[model samples]
Target: MRNFALLAAGALSLAAVATVAQGVEDPYIWLEEIEGTRALDQVKAWNKSTEELLAQDPKLASYQSRARAILDDEQQIATPDRIMGDLVANLWRDAKNPRGIWRVSPLAAYRAGKPAWRTIIDVDALGKSEKQSWVWHGADCLAPAYTRCLVSLSPGGTDADVVREFDLSSGKFVDGGFVVPESKNTAAWVDADTLLLVGDFGPDSLTASGYGRIAKLWKRGTPLSAATTVLEGTKTDVSVSPFARQDGDRRWTFLTRGKTFWTSDVSLLTKDGKVVKTPLPEDASFEDIIDGRLIAKLQSPLTVGGTTLPEGAIVAYGLADIEAGRSVAPELVMAPTKTQAIEEVAASENILWVKALDDVSGKLFALRRSDDGRWTQAATALPDNSTVRLLETAGKSDTAFAIVEGMLTPPTLYAVTASGTPAKVQSLPAKFDAATMTVEQKFATSKDGTRIPYFLVRKKGVSGAVPSLIHAYGGFRAAQTPGYLTGQPYRAGPLGMFWVEEGNAYVLANIRGGGEYGPEWHKSVLRENRQKSFDDLHAVAEDLIRTGVSAKGKIGISGRSNGGVLVGAALTQRPDLYSAVISGSPLHDMKRYSKLLAGASWVGEYGDPDVAGDWAFMSKYSPYQQLKPGVKYPAVFFYSSTKDDRVHPGHARKMAARLNEYGNRFYFHEYLEGGHSVGADHAEDAHRAALLMAYLKRELGGKK
Candidate 1:
């Protein structure tokens, strides 16, 4: 959704495709043609200019090396994507194998630091043989045996992917097996010869959000069109996808209809292939089947058979009772407090893993339910003040993997079970120089007096106002955590290694519209209130200046996708606040957001531009419409991928066109591939990040 995630994820103002009905004519509308000759020509022209300005720098190679060292570091843990009974599966990518390979290793040996490897699919080889630029999306394997799988592969890194059934044991794609043509598709294994699928059946089969609207159950030896329709949500629905979960002897199949970005409707798909509405509330998210019960996270307060679960509470309902249509009360598993937010929920055979953030710091807990239907939790002994994410979870056993890292700590992998015993599996070999850097948590008072939190990292003992960069994504319930600026390539993009090393203090703004404190924190700045997120960002920048960290025009702001909105707003709404901006795959043309692919899905977050009231507030901050002539703006470096099917590259193209028309100077680049992310591979990611870094350094003055 780069609304590129982590999509609190994921967009800018009401996302949509556009006809440019905003009274004013859009001269750059032709750029929305995506791959049109004229559009690509303009893109090439801008890309040429960009290379001269950024890539031509003598230090460009160094910037790229720093990025590759983090992205393609061979020493990086081979964190398993799934832990099979005695095997661990992962996708490995590097300088040589940029397209990556899906391979597996024995679990016992992997835990002990020795992995006897087995290759499943060599994506680089497959792509070469098939004459395609293949990118690994993921693989959904059948349960228990784990020998059969529906492997998804994307061409040119687009959201749409071609899914095929492969025999894991045979190390080959099954002859005449299930194959879904290139489309944003979903295929879940229901049984050995059956599947619950959502795909591009034909015209009008997809929703306005550019996702499948029909869910069907397809059996072996049947034409895909003959598959029985399981559920049909409206074309206006955000999306509709099939769901299947296997837990020991039980199987839970359901249909999930995403009504909006935040709320959805779930219905059970029974063994007899009948679709029945589940008793669970529509807004409640069915996370996974934990133990013998179906676990759900309540977005709003839900009343279940006499008891009401508070918003942001996790509860469990027995699968049998749910399937039998019996009146069943839910048991609360994890209830979030004001300062606590549930980050992720995963499960093993007996253990339910709940990764929560307590005051913006990572906290992992292993919650196990007793036979009496009571739940008890044990907090894992992972280092506090870091970001702890569950790297892999399995329904087969209690063995789960977690990764822990912080502003100064490199990511360390761990193996944990229901007993809350976490064994250090592998620790990141390299560490950022913490001795020279100082990390601190600071709060900026927003317009409404809310204390917005942010993390600042810089060289130790450096006094006075210095050049700096502020990065934030203040939309979607995505939380901004304390990330290693100088170590992790993800947190600060490529700037993590170079920018901080050059003495620029990097700031991460934990503004509203993020899950820092929970859903309420995000709800505070939605739609009409979205400007609060902008106000909150400006507040942080103002706080940095007022706190003697930097002066106006000395600081640079950057964000992508939804963060794209953040930087776009910062540029258009508060031009005097910063000197430079880096916005990638952004949502600038808010007026036409929904008309674009996936824009309709984000209406709940940004509001619908088609609706008058929604657009009334949306148009006010819609960056595209806010551009004015003669107003000095920080030179913005806008980068987007032409293959991006999520947030259209047109948003960036149009914004740049408008800026140029308004006599403002900006740098722009659009990759022929790379989808909505940095790029299709690390090389591309490094180059994209390098360009942004070069722009930031030049704008803010490279050295102290």
Candidate 2:
């Protein structure tokens, strides 16, 4: 069909170019090249197919039109600000307000200007003992109306006691603390007066155990009540849906552990201690239980709307037979054959929302269950050159709040109804007008003959060569879509810091290492081909310098997590290109990263060190192991969280230690709390943002 023809034409074009170049070997010779012309053409073809596919779909076209109209209408409301960073998880309107929507960041709680956020409570201020070293660890609000907020604070000093219930509205600590002794606690609110706490029960298990269960449900307001075990296991992944009200005399909670995805044994826990275990059809993964009786599951080799999903084969299921105790054979919900994987799931009463992607862009879709019990497909169209993230859902209105942005557009919060047009809720205030902003698309030829796509964002009418901070995350299947950053203090606020933004930040899209182009894209750059990612980034940076967007000594680079690996790779490969580098919670030491919490889950993305085949490929780019002595890298800033259970702090710590020992200039800071994000709460997020902005200002030659 058209896709095959396009690929053939692209190959022919590559062959022609190779013939003209004389130095090239074959059409595929340029596949390893970063930003080579062939690569750019391939990406363009992929994007073209996506656009054609969307255009052909009526559902997608309608949604796109509606989304575009909303953006066009909201453009006049507020001048978009630069979004410096965002809170990973924060408090926002659980439901839409009759007046207007409200979103409150815990970090923004301490901002000088905000006053609508009246001090519901301050746990540290009313503390009985520890002052200088106290950290808020866990927080959650009760359902229906989240009027009551509960927080837990642990003293940093010798005291291992964790204060469980500190009520925000009451402005006092609840009496008779639920102490976990020396164990860290992860709690979930079950009801108004109940909580599910997960931690270790014994001392030796607390100190040396890799996995801890001790899952117990405890009543909050009750005085030191005995804990009830809902389930017990060494390895357990628990997720609970908010209490649902079904037909008279029935309340249901869904629970799952091992073999839920592959084996599909999900238990429906009733208030009366009745556990109804439902098994799904073979090869189906139980996604979520919709409403009460309808269970959503995914089956393999699934096709939806005539598109084959790329990652693996999958079909969706909605089990209606409750008495059968097993999911009915699944029907095809959506099978986008080109997509590498689909991870996150969000749902409303009538629809199941899924975020998907091919090798070029991230796409979202919703499957609506009709009155006939059949599912109808709807493609959720977001703006071009931007990415959309679903925030929260409201039951009554069936509306969702989402954060939307693109390379040129500033991030804005929007209210999206199920079938109607989206409404703009709030936007970050722009310090500079959009008229003053200019973006240009450029291409760079990589080590091979491949052409890579890149973008440049700078202030209009600002002449001469400018100092620029170049950012990229050229790993994984994640694409760097264009979006707006409003209130980005470091990039825009202080002036003089002319930032050059690029979508090529994620350059592994088609080079066989990212899902953006599909499994083929990822497979191309896996193992020995990993160097293609580094080379792609280098080509972009070099193109910036060659094009006079930035000078060599005046340019800086940054990324976080896996992107941190990009920073290290760039420093090792092209130390002369950047003036400074900033990496946050980086996975610099790839060899030992698999042993960390959740790190083992990513071995499919990052190769396993234990495997001889992988080590040969990984050793070449592994930042921690590849550090060379007497080689001065760019001034680097490394950040890590001591409580970051995901990527171990050892990666950052070892990188800093080796860099410092070798007399390389670097700064390292490890925050004690904040988990892997290093911003457990809103206040901490704002502080982190301010610190990052300050660091960027100092490093990028902005006024301090």
Candidate 3:
């Protein structure tokens, strides 16, 4: 088993391990030495070569400047977070404030072009004062009275972060307040003097998947070590999280025991630290509590009290029934169709809002319960073919916010209510000229007869063999939705200005293993059926060529993270499909992925390789293991961060080394920091994006 072998070889030495359980020799394992002197030297050499190659592009300066300008644009929307004191909170980053500022304004003030903002914390200033990187991870405050909150800050943008209690009114960390040292952990407020803590408790306190195994109730004015453990999970379980929910006059504490990525167990915690197991479906996701009802989203079919509810439905049970251990019927709030999926479910005091997707487009609906115990719903008047997101919801009021945007439509913010017309509150100025371009939705038939949907953006009348780029992320139930350059730090304006306006086209594929069609769609391509995603992507490229949207040798593809692995498979399995590929923050060596940082946590998504059956399928398609000597692959560009603790930079490193050994044309770049994303700040992101755009233009012959 690669998992056991990797652990035996030490978590950091996948490259040094001579043989896995199968006795298979891995020659490039030395590249897995992330910080070894030899590995660092190799990374430096690769970075030099990549910089030289990209520096030769004549448009590099222009590309970088344009990207920087757009990233620093001031007309962007200030996304709202309805926090304590009825204020709208926004974390803003621009050229003037690269590290960003956490600021808040009144709802009406935030809607103006120049809001009167009061800065709570300046990350750059904090980093200077504290003499640390101090990247903001976010803050969770006491609900209803959100003045006192726990602030989570990472040293350098890693998953782990240190938590500290801060007072919003004073803009200062509370003296002698709660503070937890850096580790993968979480803390939620239970009351003014009590907190639900889940974090490292020294030896044998963490799961094999690298998450806290125990839930402890910590009281104020006491050492963290003295906290009492209320719930404990096994080392093999995925994770255990603790939280407290309030509904009207009742407050309930619970623990979510994650048995795997797809299954979980729920337990109620008593005031005396007793754990009470609750009977519920293993795949049901606890959404929220409102009106003394516990709402859950079902990932699998559930039958309760003579009524069977289908998968992908929202159901609710009375909190009293759950706590009383009595069998009760659940009220079905909503159900999804084959082409429709529930994107989000939230509650605002008395109203329940559901964000649903129909054929990859977004719609908003409001649901209400009648006295007869039936639910009535109505769709919002949001425009079609756009992405609608629930921005903020009030727990004690009837106020909510939703933002709607599309490929060509600029983002518009709306103030939504349970039974009134949605009012437009704000809108973002268009960053690029999209009047001449058109958006089209098309489908490509995959090898198994599945209709794969994809979005195409191109200039009017442009056709047949134009420089094109197709992108998709087909894992993790993360649906690829239609969006404009909204509050996102990375704007699509650069793509439209530097590519589409210059006679290039872009495509977004909605393939299997994503939640566009909900859980069933994602489950269809798990583990052994992973190739279905590759097939779906390949089919889209083929359709582009067949339908005159693109031509052979004129297309380019790009993806990061999981999508990077998809691009690697496409480059290795079908080299002639594209002219170039950008594999950023990729996972190419599947045999040893579980051994790397955060890789073990994802075994539930990708089955454990220690099992022979799982490895058989994984090894067959692993890009690093499948590279051939004379396959004539296209010139691939591999980019990543040396400090990426999630995927491990070793994946891209070893893959590039193997490609070099096979004498294939390729380029590589590795930055020393920035974690999995390969960028620490807006400036770093702009530069990396510029390099990608330049590489695409050079390889695909786009306008300079």
Candidate 4:
């Protein structure tokens, strides 16, 4: 409702800006009205232009067909995900079930090549029956028993979801069970009969970032309104949420008060409803409890209890020692190097698996505590230069599943044990022919002499003047690793297969403002240093051109979310470097972004625009504000979703509308659903991918 109101004002302001140029008024402010009839009609008109333009391209039809086929392919590996106690679950979507179906299989069946899956919930059927465009968010089942669960369903893939209590045994929604209506909410089970919830609780319940500020304990058979408030945070804070961590028979409930996007204050919720403050660095994260010890990963150097711990280090302290009010010495777990960073941490019953990145490649390590209270670490032997992700870990055993893959390699799942060798569980069949494609790790020097690493994928012995696509995301500590595309079964590496195999190339830039190196690397390009990331990207592009991999009018760049802003900045600042730009679900209007949906939360990463000092640098890189009337910008396309509640669709909408006013040759496509991504269903994703590839081909002169 806040966004809609802003859109209405922006629309009126856009109309007024053309006549009354009194102050800095937006000319396309009308487009911000996400679901307004007038704004949607305008979007329809612009979409028609894009449709007509793409219709004339000969490759569009073939690209769309190929994309749809890839997405809808039945042979695509059903990625095994463990949920509840023993059931291995998977959410599957194909041509037959576009909305996807949540299905479960036994552990034995899952480990085998083919799983005998039984449908737990058909999202498409539920959506049709309810006459709503319900998108599957996911389900959170209680540990151990795992009979009853909380299922989250979103309308058109928005961040806001309706949470309903579900009976896993009966494969049906629980009657008169706990249900939370659509709002940005989070919940965790305190017990089968109780839940800790954080969400919109009527007036004054949300923060400036539009996140929940109140935490409540709702017991079974009680109305949500009557739920007892256990904790509360100020409206200026980012959010407050509760999470229950179970270690064997011990269950620890915690409430995290997010003061900012990167920092939080953690408190332990006791059985008697008392809040006990945990002493730790505010920037440090409470990872998980292992061996009756609380673990923390520090983002900044901190002096805690007379000892200083460096940034990018994981440390642990005894939970009993803290409770007993005794002086405790923190145990050093892992400290990353200047060129390395911890990516993720997964804990089994006894061992802790740490996923770290040395440079930009993946490294897996396992840590275990011995009988003498000494911790030992061992590196897990997986494939080199491949991204390794922990699929799931059981609380009762020292067992987990890990999936490893690279840009050209297919995803292979492995059953990881505590001390033994990780055994192979499943490997996806080759989706694309990578025999001719070779991947090279290269580096480009930034303006400050920082050597930025990037991956280049191209055909062997074929080099000069190829149609290349450069990709990057340089913000929010989110490191862009070398994965097999953001790829799915049918939507396999179409870029690798359709584009690269068809004589094109792809380059992934690991620029600053990302966790490619570590917290230092990310912080180096934050706030005022944001331009360094843009500079780093340009350096990569310049390197590609200098190395003869691509030419000025032959390269295209694509990025979504933060990367959207990255490409958007590139298109504006260095328009001559690339021929095409695909900016999806982007943040182009930085000046007013803080006022938009969930935009205020990012002030920690991107400083507040209201601050004059912050605005000076932000305005320089803001793509929407940087557009000039006479600039010869290349074929730039902006795509977004109307259902996006996290980043807000208005960012793309206003930018495209602004581009139109400049008489620039650009393309705009906003899906009616699918939140902040390509879309909710495979068909929508296929169309989105097809549109991007087709546009890139048309602009960069790819083969028909």
Sort the predicted structures by TM-score, highest score first: 1, 4, 3, 2
Off by over 4 Å in 4: 1-17, 20-24, 304-307, 322-329, 485-493, 702-704
In model 4, the Cα lDDT at residue 228 comes to: 97
Tens-place lDDT digits, model 4, residues 1-704 = 11222232345435545643756477566678889897888776667667766777677777777778877887666776554566788889899999999999877667655578899999999999999999988888887777888999998889999999999889889889999888999998888889999999987999998999999999998888889998999998999988887777777788999999888998877777777767767888888888788888888887766878789888887877665556677777888877789988878888888889987888888898888877788988888888888677765657677889998898888777777477787787776777888988999998889898988887877846798888888999988888775361122226545677778888888999888877888889888988999999999988888888888888888788888788889989998887888888889889888898999998998899999999998999988888887887776777888888888788887776666555556777888888876588877777767677777777898432
lDDT on C-alpha atoms for all candidate structures = 0.82, 0.50, 0.79, 0.81
Clashes of each: 19, 53, 1, 5
lDDT of 1 by residue, 7-121 (tens): 1100111221133345537657777898899778777776776676565567888877778777787887898987766789999998878989899998888887778888889
In model 4, the Cα lDDT at residue 325 comes to 57
lDDT, candidate 2, 39-122, per-residue tens: 445434433442343233333333333323322332322211111012112322111211111123332221212213333333
Across 439-467, the per-residue lDDT of candidate 3 in tens digits comes to 88999999999999998888988856787
| Model 4, global lDDT | 0.81
Instruction: State TM-scores per candidate.
Output: 0.95, 0.64, 0.93, 0.94
Q: What is candidate 2's TM-score against the reference?
A: 0.64
Return the TM-score for candidate 4, rounded to 2 decimals: 0.94
RMSD of each: 5.1, 16.2, 5.0, 4.0
The true-versus-predicted C-alpha distance at residue 77 of model 2, in Å, is: 14
User: Candidate 3's C-alpha lDDT?
Assistant: 0.79
Point out the worst 10-residue segment of candidate 1 by lDDT. 1-10
CA RMSD (A), model 1 = 5.1
